[model samples]
Target chain A: AQSVTQLDSQVPVFEEAPVELRCNYSSSVSVYLFWYVQYPNQGLQLLLKYLSGSTLVKGINGFEAEFNKSQTSFHLRKPSVHISDTAEYFCAVRMRSKAAGNKLTFGGGTRVLVKP
Target chain B: GAGVSQSPSNKVTEKGKDVELRCDPISGHTALYWYRQSLGQGLEFLIYFQGNSAPDKSGLPSDRFSAERTGGSVSTLTIQRTQQEDSAVYLCASSLDRGSSGNTIYFGEGSWLTVV
Candidate 1:
């Protein structure tokens, strides 16, 4: 079985400030990583994904994440956040095997409150 | 639709009553998944389907929860005798085929269930 842990439950940041949300996973086999964001009252939207190659992957809304295999971590980062960035972020992982299918294990989620 | 569609964006039901949530995955998507999100539990995988066949059902929280997919497109999650603890947002997603390269799972807006 695979599991994910998001170290921070909530993070408060000021507008135009940098922010990072940490995520770690435990799995016996290789897996794919993903980051998603859910705005207030909206559905989750994919921020980015890390399947293979280029440990550093970028996504929409100027968000990026680095996949550190040795550390078993996939941390999401944004150089500058806006008021619109205030949302809940989730980290997820899926098994690499076809037999494992498309089931994803998600972390507890980190709520970001970007203030002006 | 351009993305996954879920019905009854919000539902309120009495405890012990049964409720059904529907999901319509993206066209041509062979893999579909169900996830639960709550204030206490965060995000958790429930079930998934591969072309109308469910390979795993253990992720469901209890026997009261059941899901079925027909025609490999629409899926319905049935919660029998719902409890207050079962109140949460149910999210549905769909991917291309497997956990292969460039495969991304798209999510629906989710059906919000409130059991009182």
Candidate 2:
């Protein structure tokens, strides 16, 4: 009952280029991946998280993500981007157990227009 | 309140009047969440508190939407009647006790209901 698919709603990069923001998830069991960043009015802010072991999960400003268990995906990169890294990105999922609670399941966002 | 703290950030209400949004978590952080962001659409899973247990409303979207997390950190989301699609932007998050191992879920800069 977990779902998160953010293929891209808007992504216009330029300054410094290099940006990827795609995510997918359907979850039937293990899950816990996140990458949030909303800066217009400001709220969300955790840039990276992938729960278990490494799957390439950086975070903070440099940003990074790469937990692809067979293809459930969890993309969100940023080799270089500036213009203050225009924001509005999200992709979440949570269900690593705990009786399937902790609620998160998000993804319908991906607006990173860093121009200039 | 060094982080997750929301409250009348911006409310307009009038559709039927009955809004009450407020959250204050981060002191002890025991997991508390409630989301709903609609303007562009994303984060919408409203209800979850993990401390005293017994919350997880399963993503409430009806029953007039209600929430409560009292003696364990402070949370109050009530919307009864107010329609207009219930406006939008009403996020509040917290974590550190949801199967804690690194549970990170801090957010709050929301609360902009405008049910005019």
DockQ for every model, please: 0.66, 0.29
Model 1: lDDT of residue A80: 99
The DockQ-based CAPRI class assigned to model 2 is: acceptable
What digit string (tens of lDDT, one per residue) describes model 1 on residues B1-109? 9999999999999999999999999999998889999988888889978764645786899999999998778999999999999989999998898437248889999
TM-scores of the candidates are 0.96, 0.34
True contacts kept of each: 0.65, 0.72
lDDT of 2 by residue, B1-116 (tens): 58988998999979987989999988988888888999766678888888886887977989988999889999999998898988999999888874453488899999899887
lDDT of 1 by residue, A31-115 (tens): 9999999998878899999989999999999999999999999999999999999999999998888675558889999999999
How would you encode candidate 2's per-residue C-alpha lDDT over A1-116 as one tens digit per residue?
A: 87898988999989998999999999888888988899999899888898989899998889889998999898989899999989889888888777656677788898889988
Q: What class would a CAPRI assessor give candidate 1's docking? A: medium
lDDT of 1: 0.91
Candidate 2 residue pairs in clash (backbone atoms < 3 Å): none
> What TM-score quantifies how close candidate 1 is to the native fold?
0.96
